[model samples]
Structure formats: structure tokens, C-alpha cells
Target: MKKIFVLDTNVLLQDPNAIYAFEDNEVVIPAIVLEEIDNKKRNADELGRNARQISRMMDGLRNQGRLFEGIDLPNGGRLKVELNHRSFAKLQETFAEGTNDNRILAVALNYHMEEQENPNPRPVVMVSKDTLVRIKADVLGLTAQDYLTDRIVNMPDMYMGYLTIHAHPSVIDEFYTYRYLNVNSLHLAYPLNPHEFVILKDEMGTSKSALLKVNADGKKLEPLFLSNDPIWGIGARNAQQRMALELLLNDEIPIVTLTGKAGTGKTLLTLAAGLLKVEDERKYKKLLIARPVVPMGKDIGYLPGEKEEKLRPWMQPIYDNLEYLFDTKKAGDIEKILAGLGSIQVEALTYIRGRSIPGQFIIIDEAQNLSKHEVKTIVSRVGEGSKIVLLGDPEQIDHPYLDASSNGLTYVVERFKAQNISGHITLERGERSHLAQLAADLL
Candidate 1:
């Protein structure tokens, strides 16, 4: 049976195309959702962009028919602007204030009530990205669900970019001698993705092992190019970090992704590789680093400063890593170093929207806060001869509508795993410090 889906304001804000995602089911848009979208349409962030997109879509739909009565959608669904369900009589006692959320709830409640009275009743569901709104919907006996069309993978099933395989002792020996082994030698059930790392262990449970990566052809496993060498005075502390360095330093790979807990050296390693590529090798003309400006905890309101000063707080982590790499001893030494170098640039992700960047090594820190659309916009800005590295911990997402499974970092990792130009590594160990590692695991 076809069901009726009532959308909340956040659902549309999170994904502008969500109206067409319900298939042939009837989609009800409470009039208050329009008001909320209008309020956000003038802002400068991603939310405003999405709001304007949704407004244009609704305006185009108005040409088809009267939206209040119900208009036929291209997907065989019926789109309706619910005008009569604005009454908050049903929620007045339970919810005193008739806020936008409560008003949206009232629309779904009225639909549920009308469905109960009709003999041919359709199921009513409230779709939202807000947890509390979902809870309130459940309290009112209305089914609620998250907008899950953009989710790429669950946390447990997320790709780790590498796997350990038990092989005959001879296989390990052969790999060590030849420095490359064909993937068919494994006789595994699944094919290894391009650039996927492999740890070939002795089947007899010995300590002998070989670390290799699947070549771009997806046929052979080759040894790492830089196993023990340090980049910009920083070396890989673990096997996964070694794999990450191998991908990061490779000029052939134009895109790389690194994910891990708080201190697994994702940003440090990326910056090290970027600095080496731009400074030592002169392979790229500049090093451009950016990260989304999502604040954690309660926001501190507007910051005071010039453009560079305003972005310094958000980009302080990048400067910290650069300080360690540059061995800056004084307070403003890193700033002096950056000024002298003139090849490194750090900015917010907002300024990277419409520019074409070429001959650059780009690093996107804290990429887990970006949505899929935002990531696409940033990636599409990459011109020829540029490499972009996206680093983040999916478990540490702060975007209101994004989670581990739905954020853009994981999405890009999964989508580009098969391509030869991209590589990914999920760092498993924390190398910041013993205390930091313990806190990450326990606290």
C-alpha cells in the first residue's frame, strides 16, 4: 500500500532533493516548512544554498497544478502543500508552544487521524533529521524515520582499506623475494580493490609477514614505495599509518582519504606529505589546506578579527602540526615561517566553492562534517596536476544532519575505492601520545 510521508524542515534542509526520494508515495509538506526554508534562504552557508535550491524546486512544481489540492509528481507520487492542518488543537495540551516543529507535528497528526477514519487508510510517517523531533513524533503515535537516501555505509561494515590474509609461508617468502605477487595467488572469494593494502601472514602463525598494496591494475600486490623513510621529520608509527604515507606521497594518486580516531596522525601525515610535495619535490605549486567550519558544543558566536584571523581558530590544528614539522620554538615563529615560505595557504572550506585549483596539493581537514554535496563541490574544484587529501574521523562527526554512515568523507572513500586515481586508509592506532590514546579508547 502507498504510504503518506510528512517532511520536516530539517529534512529538506539536509537534502534539497528529498521531495523526490519517497518514490510514488504521497508527500505532504506542511506550510510551516516553507516559512523555515524562507528564513534560511538568505544565509551564506550550505544550509542557505540548500534552502534556495528547495525554493526553486517548489516554485517549478507550482506550474504543474494547485499544490494545496495535490499535484502529480514525476515519480507517480502526489505532492501537496497542507494548508488546513495548521491548527494546533491536537497538540495544545501536550505541547503548549506552537513552534514550527509542533506545527509540523500537527500536520502529521491530522493526517493520521484522517487515515484512521477512512476505510482505505494509508500509513502516515514523519521524516526528519532531528532526534528530538522523531521522539516527539513517536510520543504522538506517528511513525518517524531519518532521511537515509544519502547514507553510504554503516559504521561496522565501513571499509578499513586493508585486510590481513593468512597465506602459506612460501607465499610470504615469494612476495619478499619478488617484491610483487599476483592477486590470484590468494585464491580469495572477493577481488581486492585498487590500492587496497594487504598484510600477508604466515599460515603457521609465525611472525613472518609482508606488507603490500594492490596495484592500480587490481591484479598484482606490490611493496610500499616509502616504508621507513620520514617525511618532513614525521614517520609512520604503525602499519596503517605506513599505508597512509604510501598513498599520500604517491604523485600518481590524485586523491587520498584518511580516517581514524582523535590522534591516529591523519592530519599530521597529510600535512607532512603535502609540505614535502610542495616544498621539496616542487611537484605542486602550492599547498592549500581547508576544513569545514562546524563548531563543537555550544557556538561562541561571531569571532572578532580579519579574514585570516577569523580562520586561525578553526585552522589552529593545522598550524600545530606545521609547527611540529617546522620545529618552531617561539610563539609567532610558525607565522613567520609561513610568511617566508609563501607556498602554503590555509583557509575555510567556504571559500573553495567555485574556484579552479591546479598544480596544488590540497588537504581537507575534519572532512567528516561535510555533506556529500559539499564534498562533491570541493572535489570538482580540483584542476589538473593537483592532489586532494580528505582526512577525518567518521566517528567524530559534528554536522547536525550527518553521522558516521552518511558523512562525505566515508562517502568519497567508498565511491572512489575502485578507481586507480584514488586511495584510502583507515588508521587503527592512536600515535599522538599514550595519555591521548587511552582517553580516546576509555573516555
Candidate 2:
């Protein structure tokens, strides 16, 4: 039987195409959700972008037929804009406020009670991204669910970019001598993705092992591309770090995704490799770094200054890594060096769209805050001879609509795992400090 789904504002803001995602199910938009979307459409962020998209989508739907009275969707689903719902009876007392969430809950309650009285009632499920709204729905005896069409992977089974395998003692010795071995000889648990790292251990119980990368052909495992030498005065201190550096320094792989916890050197290693490719090798004309400006909690509004000054706080982490790479001892030294070089650009991700960037090494840090559409926009901006590296700790997502599994970083990793032009590595050990590592693991 067909079911009815009442959407909250957040679900539409998180994914504008969500109205079509339920597939043949009745998707009802509360009148309050439209009000919220109108209020958010003028803002200047991803949420606002989505809100405007939703507004345009709804307007297009209105062109077809009256929205208040249900309209037929392309996928055989029915879409309706519910405007008759109002807070009634226990709703006002239970919620204690006429907030938009409560108003949306009232719509769900109205539908739910109507269904309860029907001899053969269709299920009414309130779909929202808000945890509190879902909880309140349960209290109101209404079914609620998270809009989960964006989640591509579960937390436990997320691709880690690498796995360990035990090989015969001879295979290990052969890998050490030959610097490469047939992938079939190791007998991995599953087929390794192109560019995925493998730690080949001795089957006979020896401590000796070799860190190998699956060749782009996926036929053989070879030694890391650049492991022994330091790049921009920084070298890999752990096995996973070595794997990350290999992917970062490889120009053949145009895109790389790095995932890990805090203090795992994901940003540091990517910066080091970018500097190497841009400065030492002169492979690219510039080193461009950008990150999404998603605030954790309360936004600090606009600051007074130029673009660089306005970006100082949000880009401080990038500066910290750059200053360390340059070994700047005094204040403003890094800025002076960057000004002298005139080859490095650190800009916010906001200004990256509608521009084609080429012959540069682009590093997008904190990519977990980005959505799939945002990530696609950034990747599509890459032009000829440019390589883009997306670095993020999936577990540290700050975007309200995204999570560890649903964010763009993980999406890129999963989608590009099979492509030869892309590579990924998940750094495990934290090299920041002993205390930092402890905190990352324990806290």
C-alpha cells in the first residue's frame, strides 16, 4: 500500500530533490515548511542555496497544477502542499511553543489521526532531519523517520582505503626483493580497489612487512611512490601516513581523498605534497587551498577587513600548517613569504564556483562539511593538468545536514574507488602528540 510522508523544512533544505526521492509515496509539504524555506532562501550559504532550489522546484510543480490539491509526480508519486494544518488540542500544551517544528508536527498529527480513523489507513510517516522533532513525533503517537536517501555507507562498513593481509613468507621476501608482487598471490579478503593500500605481513609470524599500493591496473601491488624522501620538509611518520603521501604525491591520480581522526596529519600531508608539486617539481602553476566555511555553532557574523582578513580565523589551520612547512619563526613571516612567491592562493570555497581552475594543485580541507552536490561542483571545476585533493575527518563533520557516512568526503571515496584517476587513504595513527592521540582515541 502507498504511504504518506510529511516533510520537515530541514529535509528539503538538506536535499532539495528529496520530494522525488520517496518514489510513488505521497509526499506532503506542510505550509510551514514553505514559510521556513522562504525565510532561508535569501541567506548566503549552502542552506540558502538549497532553499532557493526548493522554492524554484515547488514553483515549477505549481505550474503543472494546483499544489494544495494533490498533483501527480513523474514517478507515479503524489505531491501536495498542506496549508490547512493548525495547532490543536494537546499540540499546544505538549510542545509549549508554536515554533515551526511544532507546526510541522501538527500537520503530521492531523494526518496521523485521520489515518487512525480510516478503515484501511495508509501509513503517515513524518520525515525530518531534526532529532528532537522525530522524538516529539513519537510522543504525539506519530511515526517519524530520518530522511536517509543521502546515506551511502554505514559507519562500521565505511571504506578505510586500506586493509591488511597475511602473505606467505616467500611472497613477502619476493615483494621486498622485486618491489612488486602479483595481487592474486596475497589472497586478500576482497578485491582491492585501484590505488588502495595494502599492508603485506609475513604469514609465518615475522614482524617484517611491506606497505604496498595496488597499481592502477589492480593487477599488482608495488612499493609506495614516495615514502623515504620528505616533501616540503615533512615526511610520513606512520604506515598510513606513508600511504597518504603516496596518493598525494602521485600526479597520475588527479583526485585523492584522505580520511582520519584529528591529529592524523591529513591536512599536513596534503599541504606538504601540494608544496612539493607546486614549488619543487614546478608541476603546477599554483597551489590553491580552499575549505567550506561552515561554522560549528553560532556564526560570528561578518568581520571587518579585506578577503584575507575575513578568512584569517577560518583559514588559520591552513596557515598553521603552511607556516610549519616554511619554518617561519616570526609573525607575518609566512604571509611575507606567500606574498613574495605570489603562487599560493588560500580562498574560501564560496568563490570557487563558475570558475575553471587549471594547472594548479587544489586542496580542499574540511571537505566532510560539503554535500554531494557541493563536492561535485568543486571536482567539476578542476581543469586540465590540475589535481584536486579532498582532505577531511569524516567523524568530525560540522555541517548540520551531513554526518560521517553521508558527507561528500565519504561519497567521493566510495564513488571514485573504482576509478584509476582517483586514490584514497585513511590515516589511522595520530602524530600530533601523545596526549592528542589519547584524546582522539578516548574522547
Candidate 3:
């Protein structure tokens, strides 16, 4: 049976194309949702951009028929602009107020009642990105669901970029002696992606092993390009870090994703490789570092300073890594070194839009906070000869609308796993210190 889905303001703001996502199902837009979108349309951010796009889409749909009376959608579904379902009698007892959220819920409840009156009643569901709204809908006995179209992968089964294969002692010895192994020599459970890391262990109970990467042809496993050498004096402390370094330093792969919790060396390793490529090797003209501005708790708005000064607090983590890479022991020494080099540029992700970035090594830190569309915009801005690295902990997302599965970092990692130009590594070990690792594990 066809169902009626009531959308929340946040769903449309997260993706303007969400109205078309429900195939052959009635999509209802609460009048309050339009008002909310209008209120946010004037801001200069991704939210405003989505609001404006939704407004344009609604305006274009007006020619089909009256939205209040309902019109046929391109996907053979009904698109409606519900204006008169604002009565909150059903929720007044539970919610006690007619807020926008309550009003949206009222629309769903009203539709549900209307459906019940029919001989063959259809389902009335509320689709929202807000968890509290969904919980309230459940309390009110209404069906609520999250927008799952943007979710790419779940955390428990997320891609880890490397897999271990138990092989015969002779195969391990051949890999060690030859420094490469043919793809057909291994018994594989699944297809390997380009640049995917692999660990060949001796099955004869010996301790012999070799680390290899899927070559560009996907037909052989070649030894990692750099294992003993340190990038900017920061060596890989673990197997996952070594895999991450291989992806970061490789010119064949243009996009690399590094995911882990705090103290996993995601930022430090990325910065080290970026500096090596841009400064030491001169492969790129500049090392451009950018990250989303989402705060851990309180925002930086209360601080009094200019834009760069204001960003210093958020970008300080990047600077700390750079200081360590540059061996700047004293305070202000890193700044002096950066001023002299002029090869590294640090900025927020806000200014990166509407600009084409090329011939640079780009590092986007805290990328888990970005939406799918935001990630698309950033990746699309990468012109030829530019390599972009996205680093974040999927479990440590800060965006209200984004979670571990639906955020852009996970999205890219899942979507680009099959592409030859992309590589991904999930760092499993926390190398900061024993205490830090214990805190990450227990707390």
C-alpha cells in the first residue's frame, strides 16, 4: 500500500533532493517546515544553500498544480504542502505546546486519523533527522523514521582497508624474497581493491610475514613503497599507521581517508606526508589544510578576535602537529618557520567553496562532521594534480544531523573503496601513550 511521509525541516536542509527519495509514496511537507526553511535560507552556509535549493524545487513544482491540493510527482507519487493540519489537540496533552516540531507531528497525526477513517487505511509515517522528534512521535503513537538514503555504512562492519591472509610458508618466503606476489597465487575470499593493504602470514606456525599493497593493476601484491623511511621525521608506530602512510605518500592515489579515535595519529601522519610531498619533494606547490568549524562543546563565537585569530583555537591541533614535524621546541617558533616557508596554508572549510584547488596537497581534518553534500563539494573542488586527504574519527562526529554511518567521511570511504584513485585506512591503535589508550578503551 502507498504510504504518507511527513518530512521535517532538517531532512530537506540536509538534502534538498530528499523529496524525490520516497518512490511512489505520498510526500507531505508541513507548512511549518516551509517557514523554517525560509528562516534558514538567508544564512551563508550549506544549510542556506539547501534551503534555497528546496525553495527553487518547490517553486518549480508549483506549475504542475496547487501544492496544497496535492500534485503528481515525477516518480509517480503525490507531493503535498499541508497547510491546515496545524491543530495540536492530539499532542496538546503530551507536548503541551505548538512548536514547529509539534506542528509537524500534528500533520502526521492528522493524516493518520484521516487514513483510519478510510475503509483501506494507508500508513502515515513521519520522516525526520531529529532523534528527539522521532522519540516524541513514538510516544504519541506515530511512526517515525530517519532519512536513511544518505547512510553508506555501519560502524560495526565499516571497511578497515586491510585484510590478513594466512598463506603457506613457501608463499610467504616467496613474497619476502621476490618483494612481490602474483594475485592468483593467493586463495582469496573476495576481490581486492586498488591500493588496499594486505598482510601475508605464514600458515606453518612460523612468525614470518610480509606487508603488501594491491598494485595499481590489481593483479599483484607489491611491497609497500615506504616502511622504514619516516615522512617528515614521523615514523609509523604500528601496522595500520604504516598502511595509512603508504596511502598518504603515494602519488598514484589522489584521495585518501584516515579514520580513528583520538591519539591515532590521523592528523599528524597526514600532515607529515603532506609536508613531505609539498615541501621536501616539491610535488605540489602548497600544502593546504582545512577542516570543518564544528566545536566540541561551546562555539568559538564568544571569543573576541578576527577570523584567523578566531580560527586559531580550532586549528591549533593542526599547528601542534606541524610544530612537532618542524621540530619547533619553543613557542612561536612554528609560526616563524611557517612564515619563512610560505608553502603551507591553513584555513577553515567555509572559505574553500566556490574555488578550484589544484596542484596542492589538501588535508581536510575533522571530516566526519561534514554532510554528504559538503564532502561532495569539497572533493569536486579538487582540480587536476591535487591530492585530498580526509581524516576523522567516525565515532567522534560533531554534526547534529550526521552520525557515524551517514557522515561524509564514512560515505567517501565506502563509495570510493572500489575506485582506483582512492585509498582508505582505519587506524586501530592509539599511540599517544598507555594512559591515553586506556582512556580511549575504557572511557
lDDT of 3 at 94: 87
lDDT of 3 by residue, 40-64 (tens): 7986667777899999999999999
- Over 4 Å off, model 3: 295-303
lDDT of the candidates, in the order given: 0.90, 0.88, 0.89
Task: Give the winner by TM-score: 1 or 3.
Answer: 1
| Cα error, candidate 1, residue 418 (Å) | 0.6
User: Model 1: number of clashes?
Assistant: 0
Question: 1-443, model 1: which lDDT tens digit per residue?
Answer: 99999999998988898889999999999999999999989876778888999999999999999999999988899999998674689887688887889999999998999899999999999999899999999999999998888779878888889999999999999998898999999999999999999998889988999899999999999999876888888998889999999999999999999999999999999998998889999999999999888832223246786778877888899999999999999999999989999999998887777999999999999999988888998999999999999999998988887889988999999999999999999998899999999999998
Q: What are the per-model numbers of colliding residue pairs?
A: 0, 0, 0
Q: Which candidate is the best by TM-score?
A: 1
Q: How does each model score on TM-score?
A: 0.95, 0.94, 0.93
Query: What lDDT would candidate 3 get against the real structure?
Result: 0.89
lDDT of 2 by residue, 360-420 (tens): 9999999999888889889999999999999989899878888888888899999999899
Which pairs, if any, clash in model 2?
none
Pairwise lDDT winner, candidates 1 and 3: 1
